[model samples]
Target chain A: MPKASSGLLSRSLAVYFKDLRLELRTKSGLNAIMMFGVTTLAVVSFALGQSGLSPKVLSALFWIIMFFSAMSGLAQTFIREEETGTSLILNLTAEPNSIYIGKLLFNLTLLITMTTIITPMFFVFTDASTDNILPFLVVLGLGVFGLVAATTLVAAIISKASVKGALFAVVSFPILMVLLMVLVGATEKIFDNESLSAVSSELQFLIAYVVVMTTISLLLFKFVWRE
Target chain B: MWYKLVLFVLMSIMIYFSFALPAPQQQIGESSRIFYYHIPQAWICVIAFAMSMFYSIMYLRKKEIKYDDKAAIAAKLGFIFCVLATVTGAMFAKVTWGMYWNWDPRQTSIFILLLIYGAYFALRGAIEVEEKKAALSAVYSIFAFVTVPFLIFIVPRMVPSLHPNDSIISEDLKFNIEGAISLVFFSALALFTVVYIWLFNIGVRVQLLMRKQLEEEDF
Candidate 1:
């Protein structure tokens, strides 16, 4: 028999794969998030009409699209568990930390898929363009991870609650506010084609935000997961 | 009961010194008086939040109802003072900066703090099961307080803040603080802390009463 430590990685991976399989079967989480992203992008670009938009506006708009899109569906990760009556069985099988890691991975995958589809569409539809792809992607990557770490735990909390709708945004906005602020600042620099030196501080802040959020969530998840 | 008398005395002293004794500084003029209320309210907000998180950790470790009750009351008071800080700070900003809402990084950070605890209450209100409500909110309080340091300290440094009141409760360290003003400030802080304790005890009593009534009804 494999010891728990020996199987920890594979255990989490198995949970992740299980989520992936379920996601492939229904794709509801993917569809809702993507549709919201694309539709919001279309509306925003249509309203602006490709004229004299500033770097700050473009950067802010990009996150608003991504942020709202995320809010639309991320809670469904744990909500699905409750709704489907599988949470109890899943609860009995995997360690709480492993379950949390799996749910976080699943949420992150859904976010990535939605962003991948919406990101280029954002630049295409809107007049926003970034000259520095690498730094922008770096910020985007960290920002997404921060959002995932922050929101995934929040999603878990709300999943158990009766009122899920507004609470997610209320709880998540505070944690994400710093992340979104730095991302917008970094993205504005990317828009202006500024050197990495320009966005270095914001990037560092994002890295810190990510580390702090994930650490806190990991510590608190054990309490949140169990009865 | 004796602590209540002490709270009353502290409140009276805090009022007199804050309203009458402290010398108003130049540049900002008379409006600077807002600093007394603003600073204490913000401190209460921070301290109360810390207390909530402490109780949250306690709840998680002990799984006790009383710990959850302590956590809940602390957070609720924290949220109340968070709003007070925001409003009082907004008024202060209006006088100093010519607008009520400057989106100062400090203001924005406080705004974020408000939302975090607001979500805490919302989470509490959502669950019908008593134990689940307590446990989930305790967990969330811990999660939310984790961001307070980032919001209050790191965010301001990251952004070039125009807020004159950037210091997080550095009122004592100010060179501008005369002995009189220092007396007032410390007294106000003591008063606010007592007020918090008073409110916290009241909240716990009410919670206990509610639980008792529920038990009686079940019987």
Candidate 2:
């Protein structure tokens, strides 16, 4: 990979292209994420009795699927790189900040796309009606951003652990608190017929969290990746 | 080590103030004395987590094992402060709420924090390799600290509570000599921080010494 200027967006785009092409050929990451999302929703619905899946409940369900689904997807982000011995290759060629942003963008894409596909399936199966789907989507969208940034950093750390999959949750559970709280709070408003304006504060919080977390991740990626 | 004297001086000052600091204008009398320990411990807990997260990130960026050691020390200190906070809060609850553990939001949140950090140390001990241990521990510390705000801020809002709701300063509850009270609190925070630093330095040196001893044996 040729080195690009330090503009995060451009670097992220480049790395995204690289991962996208690899993903397109393999389709492994996409297939795995979607499968995890659908399966998780199915299990949750079956266990909880689909009758309880109201629109408000669906909103909460939507973020839960994204969370756990993205978790499984991200668990392997750095692991796959390391397993293939390409982590060092990629790290050597790309700056740490670029790698962090690139991974973050890619993870966000994975989470959002999976949520989009799985959410309608949830509505269809559970017969839930979301009054204002836009707010729900926006809340989920902001949440996915926080998830990607937070999980990406964690995924980097757990990739070096002896137990990658199990440790990912241990590492991410704490960091996911704010996003989960905001997601649940904003999602519950769907039941009460509140305006999107109510969720604006949470969305702002998510955005601030994303900025702070990603910056820290960017600075720390180089050290963690050194291994 | 020099800060030990400062800690003693601050401790004496706090003790002196504890006697004179009037009770809040409400029902509580001598029970309010718990605020000095309870509030400062909460502050220290937050500070310790912040230090752990900062050092964790530094460890990842610099690939310095020292940062990992520092993070671990910070986390241990944070855990200790959290325990003290929980105990003092429980003591306060026993006096004010007529129960030691009411499952209040603050109590529950502190328990959650304890679990998270407890799991952190457990995870560190389970991992064997030097590099892998540092990396995994750093990741956990970062994530766990990131979650602290949620435990501190959001969990409390999840349910109603008798614990005084979040307020930096309450007008209704006034300390006539507020400046002196703040100085007392600030001194306690600084004292705890210095003690933490001293302990952390000792921990790092001990670990280094052990590593050197292991290397000699290997040779």
Candidate 3:
């Protein structure tokens, strides 16, 4: 049993690394997401035209960019597999659980890398400030995980559809709505210089969202993956 | 036939009493009458979504076409009721809040509900293969239902809003319903649920028959 479990872990990691290598080699998914994020930030910053926005508006804008950027790129994880006809080889090589975990890890890496690039640019462009930097980072981390967990399975589901792009956003938006709302709320508080303790409920909710969404996605992925 | 007649009479009585009864509260006055319709529609909507989720799970477990049919019917009915609830709630809000739409927590939750179920139909429409449609939609249905608790319960409490969470009970959580209002409210709830079940049965039968006809034509 121990050996079997280890094999599963190794296989999952292999799937993750394979996707990572593909992403790094092609850079298509990463490039698309980064360009979308940066372009949106540029457009938004240009539109505001030096007028300072409130924390509420700024927080909303930041997550909106993140959400749309995610929508633009995350589906590529599975859609690429389908488009390239690699999914059949993947199915033959690994279990659905491992494939899902691997794809999930790849998405997590992609999104984190995207945010790392976009976050500073977001603050610089919008002049958004948060006093509680640690809490803000915590929010961003959990929000990214929650977003990926909720949408990874959805990416798989939509990859099978004819109209993949629009369907991906329509399907994912409602699922991510809960996560986005909590992130915006917590970030707004942080921007207002609220203490970590003040946004604890939002923090807890984000943690719960990630855990619940990840678990549910793991359970449901097999159904989407098999056929 | 007998039950349908009974349902018709009960609904008529409920509607008449809802208006005839005194205002549930003095301040909201007659506008409060919308509650009789609004709450029941919202309740049926939630119940129908739950039914859809239940059937979806059964379909996933049993791999039966009948369960998928039932689930789809329940979702279609749920979506209609969801829209009805939103419209009626908006009407009530307009009467009381002096606007057609307020981003009140309850309003926001219902709006998200509409989006969630709307997405469910979009998912069903996207898949071409029948089994794939059944399987994928069933999975998505369960996935969407999981977020509903957060939408309905947690989101409202997180934000301070004008929604009257304590309208029926005070802060201390006391049960306070006038005798006449409770009668109308409970009856409305029961009758609306029956109406929902009746519509759901009709929908499922129609769906199964349509599918059968399609199969025969193919044969």
Query: Which candidate number has the best lDDT?
Result: 3
lDDT at B71 for candidate 2?
A: 85
**Pairs clashing in candidate 1?**
none
Q: Provide the lowest-lDDT 10-residue window in model 1 chain A.
A: A1-10
After TM-score superposition, the amount by which residue B33's alpha carbon in candidate 3 deviates from its true location, in angstroms, is 1.0
Clashes of each: 0, 1, 0
Tell me the spans in candidate 3 whose CA falls farther than 4 Å from its real position. Answer: A1-5, B161-175
Report RMSD (Å) for each prediction in the order shown. 2.4, 4.6, 2.3
Q: Which scores greater on lDDT, model 2 or model 3?
A: 3
Stretches > 4 Å off in candidate 1: A1-6, B161-175
Global CA lDDT computed for model 2: 0.73
Can you give the DockQ of every candidate in the order shown? Answer: 0.75, 0.31, 0.78
Q: What is the model-wide C-alpha lDDT for candidate 1?
A: 0.82
DockQ sort, best first: 3, 1, 2
TM-score, first chain, each model? 0.95, 0.90, 0.96
> Model 3: DockQ against the native?
0.78
Q: For every candidate, give the share of true A-B contacts it also has.
A: 0.83, 0.26, 0.72
Candidate 3 chain B minimal-lDDT segment of 10 residues: B166-175
Candidate 1 CAPRI assessment class: medium
Give lDDT tens digits, candidate 2, residues A1-227.
54565577787678777877777888788888899888988887787765765555666776788777887787665777878989877876777777777777777777778877987887777666667778877776777778888878778777766667777776577567556756776777765677888767667777777787877677657666775
